[model samples]
Target: MEDFLVNINGTLLKGPEAKISVFDRGFLYGDSVYEATRTFNKRPFRIDQHIDRLFLSAEKISLEPTYSKEVILSEVLKTIEAAPFKDATIRIVLTRGTNSDLGLDPALSGPNNLVVFTKEIKPNPAWWITDGVSMIFFQKKIEASGSLPKTGNYQENILANREATSRGAYDSFMINTHGHVTEGTTSNAWVIKNNILFTPPLADGVLDGLTRKALLEMAKRQMLPLPLVEKSLTKDDFLSADECFITSTTRNVVPVTKIESHLIGNGKPGALTLKLLELYLEFVK
Candidate 1:
């Protein structure tokens, strides 16, 4: 079994053998929509939602996919199945194909190029979950609007994460121009105050993360005492919260112990955050 696999259009190839044209808009202008789905117990988790979001992203960017959603889904499953790992990450990318002319106009583009690949899942450091991760406030602004689709453009996030790492932090929480804490570099940010869950609203331009959606659903069905409120949050709010956490596809729910110099609560994963993580794990099972 191969450690990695790539499916270009309908052809499967080893990861090192996979290739795309340099003239492809996805490489040149980041003109692409993509989705990342991870497997649990050798089976895909929330694959339908991921694929749906992929189509939604394509629609938002006005980039028509070369294949139907069903076809894309089938291709993703096929690639994952061909991978060697018991648990893996599957990435589906749809890029505007190479243009006849070296121009920025979409009209010059050809058919979309669909690429699906699978790789081994990399878990977060044990300390990240056991002791919680330290985060810093990234003052730099992200150029992409939160409402935009999950496209190939990620320069801003890359820079933010780099800055965070340089500053000796696990990740960075980006603040908008208005001083509102939008989100983490790649995850959805959340804070618990007085037992109430607070996160930036989608209206604030934050991506509608699937993990965030799942958490909200779980919270509602479990009927938590306080309702999970979606509101515009500021850095001060996060720093002063009783507990803090972030959610993503790979890292489901991780506690945030410190933000900058301030220690959140007791500086360890709070009870509520741990409880929620337990519930989330059970939900995943």
Candidate 2:
């Protein structure tokens, strides 16, 4: 069994001992905001960006953080120092705390903060990178229109991702009610078409990912001449894309060689996908 260090409130606990009340609104009602980050060569990548996003998510969900950004940042460093794994992923979860039995009102909920010890990222698979993964178009749409911000209501993702796995797919591409391919179950979607990178607009209801932001910057720096196009995409458009990939904290960049039965550009990772992955890795290192 592996050991882990967990922080509940401000106290650190060994694996198997960390606990929160069952009445926590976050657990009972999914009223929580969270962030995931990976370390490169034992150093956290984009720590500031991740923390900033965490705060933004918490604010969106109305969770009052008891600690300031400086405090949380220090805590994250402490967690890394105590961890056994040199290279690891860090998960910071902030719950809306426990609600008074009087009612389920978030207004009365207390704060529930937890930091978990993490380890080496278990990237999808070698084949996922070399041969690329496949995606299934889920009939389900990621939360469409009218922004929910960061309510942490992830049930849709839970159900859709489970469906994807049950169907033997690596991930699911969640379309919106408007029929635009928005994002993946846990990653942001990007498509390469006619040598340009295209992704669903923020209006399409996808989480603005840190890696996505970085990629956009890289594209600008290289003067790639390729536009980071943002527009609604239909299933047919995705099927015909020259290449497709998803980005997130874990899978830095993973190509999608197929969508359902439609083969993605010769059924292999595209040249642009490889270049982007290399550039991203170099940026971190």
By TM-score, the best candidate is 1
Instruction: Provide the TM-score for each candidate, comma-separated.
Output: 0.94, 0.92
* Model 1 per-residue lDDT tens digits across residues 152-201: 98777788899889989999998877778888988999999998999998
Model 1, poorest ten-residue lDDT window? Answer: 139-148
Task: Put down candidate 2 lDDT per residue, 1-285, tens digits, no spaces.
Answer: 145677666677776887788788777877888888887767987989888888888887667787678888888888787777677788887777787764668777765655555666665688978899988987664446633354557788878888888988888999888788888978889888998899887778878888888888877787444678778888988899999999987779999999998899999999888888888877766
RMSD of each predicted structure: 1.9, 2.0
Off by over 4 Å in 2: 1-3, 141-143, 146-151, 223-225
What candidate 1 gets wrong by more than 4 Å, as runs, is 140-146, 223-226
